[model samples]
Target: MMKLREIAHSRTGDKGNISNISVIAYKQEDYETIKKSVTPEKVKAYFSGIVKGRIIVYQLPNLWALNIVMYEALGGGVTRSLSLDTHGKSLSSLLMDMEIEEEENEAN
Candidate 1:
């Protein structure tokens, strides 16, 4: 197994109670592995404790990235939330910690 960070990097953004995260592959060839391994269900489950609503994933093959939209994930938006990470900027870092199967070539 390999961590998502091994092949990709992520960026985070927010609006109201929603969190938008984009996972971009470091190499175009690895995009397929990321797409197959990182599903909306998996992302939802990963942040199950924090996100209270539905999740949506949009594929951008040309960009080699996945855009994940998480609803009700900011604990009621930045100004209203009591959490330190109300903006959820650190979410990208947290997501990179998720484990996934390594690419076939990397297993050798």
Candidate 2:
């Protein structure tokens, strides 16, 4: 197993109750591995406790990145949320911690 952070980095943004996170690969060659491993369903399950709505993933192959949009994830936005991370800035870190199966060659 390998953590997503081993080959990628992430950034996050928020609007209302929605959160947008971008997972970017350090090398274009690793983009396929990230794409194969990181699915919307997995992301939703990983954040099930915090995300109340649906999750959408957009693949940006040219940029070697994936855009993850999650709804109702902010506990009611920055103004209304009682959680410490109202803006959800720390979500990217949480996502980076997700473990994925390493490619066969990489595991060797």
Candidate 3:
């Protein structure tokens, strides 16, 4: 799971659901490394059951940063399929709290 540490938080226009979140490094000097940590597969695992949309990422030029946009992930596409759960927290923050589990598989 990805560790989602909250940086900035903003709610969508409806204010009923949907949110815009930005996250930075939880640990010092790990910005670049951390940014690289957020892979699509990791997002799947970190979000687990609550997520249901396309995740997009944009890398900032000349900076150790990545901007992620999770589309249609809020309220399960606004069709009553997604519940306003998650405890009213930024998804990025939620992701900040997760740590990717590393394995000991050796390279050939």
Candidate 4:
């Protein structure tokens, strides 16, 4: 299973309940694999079963990586968790659970 290292994470905005997340490769070389793994479609798929919101993906030219921002996920500004909730879903868990198609892997 592929593993992702969380480089940074934070809320979407001061009052919004959304989660904006950033992650990178544990090993810099893994950036290619990570880029191959994460796509706009994959980002949408990642949050499909667990979160209800809009997911935006952008490529980081400088880093050869990607970033996904989950908007309006925490039920707007009404609810926020204090504990594990403070942390979005585990990066490792998300990567492990992903279903990467064979064709995509082959293209990489």
Model 4, 18: alpha-carbon shift in Å?
A: 2.3
Query: lDDT per prediction?
Result: 0.94, 0.95, 0.50, 0.53
Candidate order by decreasing TM-score: 2, 1, 4, 3
Name every residue pair that clashes in candidate 3: 2-98, 3-95, 3-96, 3-97, 3-98, 4-95, 4-96, 4-97, 5-96, 75-82
Cα displacement (angstroms), candidate 2, residue 28, comes to 0.7
Itemize residue pairs with steric clashes in candidate 1.
Answer: none
Model 3 regions lying over 4 Å from their true place: 1-20, 26-28, 61-63, 76-82, 85-89, 101-108
lDDT of 4 by residue, 1-108 (tens): 322434221223323666555545555655666667667577767667544777776667466556666765554443555435444545334544455432234556
Top model number, TM-score: 2
lDDT assessment of candidate 1: 0.94
What TM-score would each prediction reach against the true structure? 0.94, 0.95, 0.56, 0.56
Candidate 3 residues 1-108, lDDT tens each?
Answer: 323343222222222234344444544454555566666667666665655666666665444455666655566444454455532354554665666433233573
- What value does the lDDT take at residue 34 in candidate 1? 94
Which stretches of model 1 miss by more than 4 angstroms?
Answer: 106-108
Q: Which regions in candidate 4 have their CA more than 4 angstroms from the true location?
A: 1-15, 78-108
Off by over 4 Å in 2: 106-108
Clashes of each: 0, 0, 10, 0
